[model samples]
Target: MISGPSENPELWAFLESLHRGEILCGTVTAIERFGVFVALDDGPDHPVFRGVGVITIPELSWQRIETAFDVVQVGQHVSAEFLQFDTWNLEARLSLRATQPDPFQAFADRTAAGQELHGRVTKLVPFGVFVQVTDGIEGLVHLRELTSTSVEKPSAVVQAGDEVTVVGTEIDRERRRLILSRRQGPTAH
Candidate 1:
């Protein structure tokens, strides 16, 4: 059997003390394409690394970021939520965005179905175009919703960075999903 962090008594003990959702403060030691490494305060020294904590790209921020550097830099001190213990890597899995407000939740709080909003097309998929209705919120405009006329592909109707008007067809706060339509639809009363 492959040995794991549990074999290290000190590290195992330290990991036991950590609870999910607990906030942890640490200095970012390194930033890579895969994730960010942090030297957590009050944690035992890692046996092989400068830090004992890792924050994956998706945990770095709620907003869509091109890279981990977009959210944090090396040597920056940050507070992140404890996600879990990585047994294989012997690191604490952290979430920086958990310490920050969810922009999508905030957007959903103020937005309602049938609300018309202006946005820029951010991406085009085979099925639909994604429109950035706000800084961190993007809604899908399905192919049929691209326009009143039938379209074969999203690119045929919209391109990235194209300014467009869309109506909110659904704002699923629970799922954190928002559906939009280019064709004018009923307004929220």
Candidate 2:
């Protein structure tokens, strides 16, 4: 069902508040490949859509994930940033990532360079491997860091889902980049 402002007075007011960037808590009503539909608490219902809020894929989480379920599930309650009215669909476009605490910030606050931690390789890139060190936190292991021996590709030493120990070499808080090294006594699966 398409969404838009309803004739209900209270619903119109809710949409107005949402347009002002008001953060709201809502129960996820449905999960689709494209987005999550939310039944907002204290929010006006769409005349036909039944729910009033929608969070698109990119807005689901900070972490790169395979699907929306990786971050949230049906019936889960979530707090989201109300971006703006999706006039094309007449629904309030929301961002779930904006409301969650950043895991990278927490990981950096207590961690220092040269510390070791275990992580699972998440993605293999031409130049590096992306590893998930913790929930919502990932670091890049450059091709040079994957092995001491000269290698042309990162896949030579690492593949997705391999568990490896990594040493933190750099953490750029401003850019939110975490650099890791696997050369220091780290064994890969």
Candidate 3:
């Protein structure tokens, strides 16, 4: 179990003062492949790190990025949402994406099952191909839905960067999932 500020009064007091989901403004102090460090405005100084806050790769942005440098740079000002207090690291976990609109939610709002969508195949796995339906939104085209006939692998049907037309078979908003099909005809209602 994670302990609160009472465990270490001085180092954790700044994080204790913050609440989850609270918006915070900070400057990007360091950008690593794994995450970014932020020195929060009006926050206490840290003895070990340049900042008292950290934002992991997944929390940096909603879009799939190759590196932390792609989304942020050192000394850049950023507004992030407080996620949690990291007792081990003695820093507050933050999320830069939380401050931005969720692309998946926006896509789900305007899209419906059976809708036709044009996208580029982003990745191929043993089970399916991931298609980028829109910026920051990728949907899975399961192997079974790749075609009417049986296939051994997704690579046989499509390659990365291949532009394809797919029909949305299911839109699971709660799961943030979109199931797509490329079965050569209108999707059955």
lDDT, candidates in the order shown: 0.88, 0.82, 0.87
CA RMSD per model (angstroms): 2.5, 4.1, 2.8
TM-score of every candidate relative to the true structure:
0.92, 0.73, 0.90
Q: Give the local distance difference test score of model 3.
A: 0.87
Count of clashes, each model: 0, 0, 0
lDDT of 3 by residue, 1-189 (tens): 234567657767777788999998989998887898999897876667888889999999888888999999999999999999887778889999999988889999999888999999999999999999998889999999897888999888889999999998889988888899998446521
Question: What TM-score would you give candidate 3 relative to the actual structure?
Answer: 0.90
lDDT of 2 by residue, 50-99 (tens): 46899989899877767888888889998899999666555788999888
Candidate 1 residue 77 Cα shift, in angstroms, is 0.6
* TM-score leaderboard ranking: 1, 3, 2
Clashing pairs in 2: none
Best by TM-score: 1
